[model samples]
Target: MNTLSPTTAAQAPPSRWALASLSLSMLLPSLDTSIANAGLPALAGTFEASFAQVQWIVLAYLLSITTLLVSAGRLGDLMGRRRLLLCGISLFTLASLLCGLAPSLGWLIAARALQGLGAAIMLALTLALVGETVPKARIGSAMGLLGSLSAIGTTLGPALGGVLLVASGWQAIFLVSVPLGLLNSWLAWRYLPADGPFAKGKPRGFDLPGSLVLALTLGAYALAMTQGHWVLLLLAAAGAGLFVWRQGRVAVPLVRLQLLGDRQLSAGLAMSLLVSTVIMSTLVVGPFYLARGLGLDALAVGLVLAAGPAVAALSGVPAGRLVDRWGTRRMTQAGLLGMALGGTLLALLPSASAVPGYLMPMLLLTASYALFQAANNTSIMAGIDPQQRGVVAGLLSLSRNLGLISGAACMGALFAFATAADVSIASAPALAQGLHASFAVATVLIILALLISHFALGKRGQSGTPD
Candidate 1:
């Protein structure tokens, strides 16, 4: 367990192998998140479960990842990032194996939860590790590349999963990660820098009580969202209060409350939440419309959905350079505006010949995501000190996860309510109406995000401060 002192800086450029390993490690989690959706019907049929029950396969994974992210990040800081990354890759691989061999829906869901835990660890550390490894001058570009890989993984998941499902089975989707995870683990072991040793005289280790409380808070909130249970919401509130109190009292708290005082970082986190919410919402609603409303097959739906992230992936490197030159504020504003425009376009799409309409809006939305993610992440990470990178990175990841869960829940609820009469068997017209309503809601959210960015983010050439 080697550890570098907080004050120490990288003496040379990061190795390309190290960066490649990080990117490869990231792909598993990002791909898993979206890939399960494509195999939902197959999973349901195999397990003799209904659609609602099969949904747990996805929801369980999401809940586990979101709830554990902050804790994993803090632990990485206390323990060792390289160590955690290897462990995560190993655990994810094992979990993927379990998922592929699952005997029942319950077993699959449980395996997915385990997989999510591995993802949480990896997601929490990926950016922080990259920041530590890369030069300050090129942080934006590095983050941009990582963000692009993430976008590609997410976009490619469904398409790849569809092909796998048709060629092999639903189990193949989970099994796919086994070899990739092993390769990533080996690459990480060989390439990643070590954290020399735990700092001397630091509070004896991570704050277990605080971590527990925070996990409870996040878990309860996720359950409330997924189950629509008021009791879980109340528990979440209580857990949050206790967690906050514990943080103020504990030595080396899981998260330093003081970090939230930085306006730029805080705003960046908020914007990340909003942007992710819009992205996830669109991903969910768009597929439903394309598959059900338009009567397209899985392959067509996957292709249609891939366009947005594909555009984002293609433009990511350019967006990163622009952020370095033009600053985060300008790029973020432009991105948000693009998202608003995309959402508006989606809302106006007609029921017939919707593929063209969907493609154009998705392109705009994903491109916006590409631009916003790199710039916003760079701004947030730049504000924090090196010693606090892991926790701050966790917070950043937490914002995105929270946004994703909330977006899925909110949009899912809205769509369900809008089509309540035809909930079980919705007609094309009914599905179209629901999608239109959802897109309109997304448009409103983008506008709200724009206002938040304008008020909370700094102006052009002033990316360092909040307005």
Candidate 2:
């Protein structure tokens, strides 16, 4: 396989076919997140599983994919990005097929894990590909398109899953990816030129031992978050310690800790984590209020919730421009402020309210989020050297996933307390109390993120000029 592209204007611009390949590759993973989300009840009945079991089918995929993407991204650099992308597409397609055919919830969960692995490779390397294929001046546009697609995925996930669930049932949700995955694979093979295998010299091995340590740590962390296992959380700390030690000594560590030393990249990663926490938890909170508390139908709730992601996508181009001018510090600061406003709006929402009250704040939050998501990613990716693209991609993916994990766990605990009071979500005061506490926490997290960006990214961090 060929390695990095020679930095010359090639015979052709990356064709629409090439963009299609990358976009479709991106679309599948984005689809999987929400496609199954709205169909959970149908899936539970089909498999005869409980609510908790159904949740994991999605949660497991999130955790596994997040964990693997960083490693896979680095591997893409070491091996070949095109090769990794193709392999990921194939695996995702195969896993989607398996998910459709799953005999039990257990089987579906396992299948989803494989799908996550495939997504990790594709997501992590997507920008890396853009870095290689697109000219420097056009890279921002390419990344803008990427941000818009990601936002589109977020917006469409619920609606797409709802459609599949209504039309055919839960299995069809998984099956939806088959065509898209195949199309992506075919396009990549056709439009993407072959590249060299990574790192021709030294035979630098992947740090499997460190991977195991990280797996143990993050696995434990995810389990503790999902199951509320405090003991496992303790074990996770120990695992993290060992993983850090291992990475320092290993030549090509699974996670290069030195990358964290880049202040801007570090800030970008932190903000990604905190902001994802706030947004994802809001997703958790909003549906509960709509469905159980207000007694709205699932379809209506899904539609109402779609507003956030929709706003996010719409804001992408403008947000990218802001980042181009003001930099991530200002954009991320604004994003966090919007999040704080969103939480306040939700706190003031009346019981049995229409989508309007919730939507306005969500819209603001989404618009701000567009900048945070894209700008932070650009900051982190731009901070790293070309050689470390995969690794950085992996780290970015990891930070976001872990942040979501943290958010989910924290919110789960909060909700549990509120629910224990026998105050249904329909009780405006009760719901507000819970959301207020959680959102306050999220606000603080965002503030800390802003501080990190202010101090770590701008003048102090020598990653590079923002891409």
Candidate 3:
């Protein structure tokens, strides 16, 4: 795999500009994730549909994005990242408009799914585009910016989406992106250069069958993880193993499993899943504890929960610098250790816990979340190459999203299992038990990730380059 020579310090392509555009592209999907959770009731009222029917609008978006993200990223490389960006932006904008004007639940759901397709393409490919346009050395900075933007979008999305819903109704939420999308598309075409000369990976185009296998395998896995049916989990594992096998046989696969030949890359992916699961699970548990156990209002819980990610976005830049200087191993270790400590502390807190005690741990947890995310993003992007960026980005996105989803599912399962075992959660005590269990599970995942990272970084003697 070929990489471009490092660009001189004077010629940075103003990574900040590329950062802004890519960030804009990324903001849409992350924002869309919970952007409509609140709007569901309103949408049901408007379309005169049942609550369950309206819920499909949100679910459709998740299902579509998760299923198609890998394919979308590969397609970006096979065609052109910029071309796909423009197309996706166009489709996304149109879908947003349609969603705003949706006269019925079905139309809104369909439109939202269309929006998901665009978002999936944009999400996976934007990282790839960053690799192509930005120099390799500053790639860490680019990744940090991307990581910050993702956190910012999530942190700001609920309020932003809520405001849009209130100010101009649901139409405003979707309409806001249309102009941004158009403007972003025009700017990308003008500025983002084609960098095929320094492309990486096997160099052949994508394999459609390989992509479908991934979709089936990963898609099934996501379903199983979400629903937590044992049968589905087994099927997902089988499908994933076969998908990997199939990729090995194909000269130019959608996902190049050979990338994993390096220990660090594998470790990085594992660390991402583990840390993400811990953070995400705690987040889910925190809300439930506040809402049900402690008897707080939804609004209060949201505002309180928002504090963590907000701090995370603010801390991203510093974390990136640390990643560049300290190397990923130290940062990864520190971040995970901090996360485990914070989560464990939260779980161990007494039922009558006060704000003062919670505040410190919350901030620490937020910092860990920020540090781990920025460091991992840097390591993963730097770990692979320009062409394989698509598949690598896809896997990173897949695992990260999957971890968050799985965290929530695991919490529920823990509650069910504990309940069956007759664990009394008087203050909706099962919530804490579930969270504790999730944290413990996350700790195991991170420990495994740490071992993988050690090997991935190579033995004491070898250069830490990709295998």
Candidate 4:
């Protein structure tokens, strides 16, 4: 049950195998997300379920991960990260098997929820482990590699799932993870640095109440967003207030309130949320624009949409190297500005220009995203202490998840409102209107993020913080 590596080893050069293990952890969760999405139609047919019912297969997974991420990270800090990660991989593998074998929609959804819990552990600890495995000088590169792999998984998932679903049915989509999970488990156990014997001291106590309240709050929020229910949203707000009050009073809180005072960490989280929200617009709005506005068929639309993630995957490692060379703050600002430019182009470009017009802006946006993610993560994690790494990493992931959730809910609504009609049957002019409006708002969001980054990172610079 080893957790934190010795300080000397933590500062040493990273083993390529260790980095590969971490990268795979990132891939599994992201891959599962897109893969499951692609299989929803098949899943619905298999279980004779309504669309609403089958949606739970995805929602359950998201809800579980969103609710439990922070708690999982804090637990890793208290117990042992490597040990917990292996447990997570094993759990995910078993749950995948369960999902594949499920006899009913309810069973599959439940298994997906269990798998998401494992994914939370994996996602949270992978970033935390980065500091332990990689030398500080190459932190950006490592973060970039992880980011790239995540994008690759996302880019590949739908295509892979479609093939599997056609060849072997919906079950194969979930079943695919079993072997990957097994290999990941072995890699993690064999290559990840081992924990030393538990240090002699009073063992850290877990915050059961805080974890429970936070989970409930996040669950409520996720459901509210997905279901579009005002009552659930209100409950989520109340639960959030209660969680904050609880955290302030507890001695061993799940997350220390004071940690938010770190300008770099706080700003990084905020920027990640903002940037991710903007990114989600592509997924939410792009499909409609391509299909209705540009008159692309389903296959053409899919191919066009895939370009963004593909660009992101290809640019990740290079983006990280740029972050390392130029400095995190500089690279961060550059990425934001680049994204804003892309957003502006999307907003201004006429739909008559068709796929090329759409792709130029999207390519810029996704590539800049890779840069922003790598720089932002390295900026925050490079400065965090070992004991708090897990929780901080979890917070980063949580913020991004929340942003994606928020974007999917809000941006989709915005697009619909702009269209002023049913998107499915909207006229080309109406759909183009929606696309322009969405990207305009997205550009605004990026500008806001840039302002925040400027002020926050400027403060960090003034204080002479080292990254």
Q: Name the best candidate (by TM-score).
A: 4
lDDT of 4 by residue, 1-467 (tens): 12344674754444788898898899999899888888888888888988899989988998999999999999888888888899899999999999999999889999999999999999999999987777666778899999999899888998999899999988899999999999999889888877555567735889999999999999999889888999999999999999999999988899999999988889999999999999998999999888888888999999898889999998999988887777888889889999999999998988678899999999999999999998899888888877888899999999999999999999999999999999999999999899899999999999999998998877442211244
Per-candidate Cα lDDT values, in order, are 0.82, 0.74, 0.72, 0.89
List RMSD in Å for every model shown. 3.6, 3.4, 3.4, 2.5
Instruction: Give the higher-TM-score candidate: 3 or 4.
Output: 4
Query: 161, model 4: CA deviation in Å?
Result: 0.9
Better of 1 and 2 by lDDT: 1
Ranking by TM-score: 4, 3, 2, 1
Candidate 1 matches the true fold with a TM-score of 0.88
Name the runs in model 1 displaced over 4 angstroms: 1-14, 40-53, 103-107, 166-171, 291-299, 348-354, 416-437, 459-467
> On residues 45-101, what C-alpha lDDT tens digit does candidate 2 reach at each position?
888889988999888788777667777887887777788899999999999999999
Error of 3 at 194 (Å): 2.6
Q: Which candidate model has the greater lDDT, 1 or 3?
A: 1
Ranking by lDDT: 4, 1, 2, 3
Clash count per candidate: 7, 7, 3, 1
Writing each residue's lDDT as its tens digit, candidate 3 over 84-194 gives 777888888889889888877888899999998998888888877766666555655666777777888777766777788888898787787788888777666666654
Cα deviation of 351 in candidate 4 (Å)?
2.6
For residues 55-159, write the lDDT of model 1, one tens digit per residue: 999988988888888888888887878898889999999999999999998999999999999999998888888766765656677778889888888878887
**TM-score of model 2 vs. true structure:** 0.89
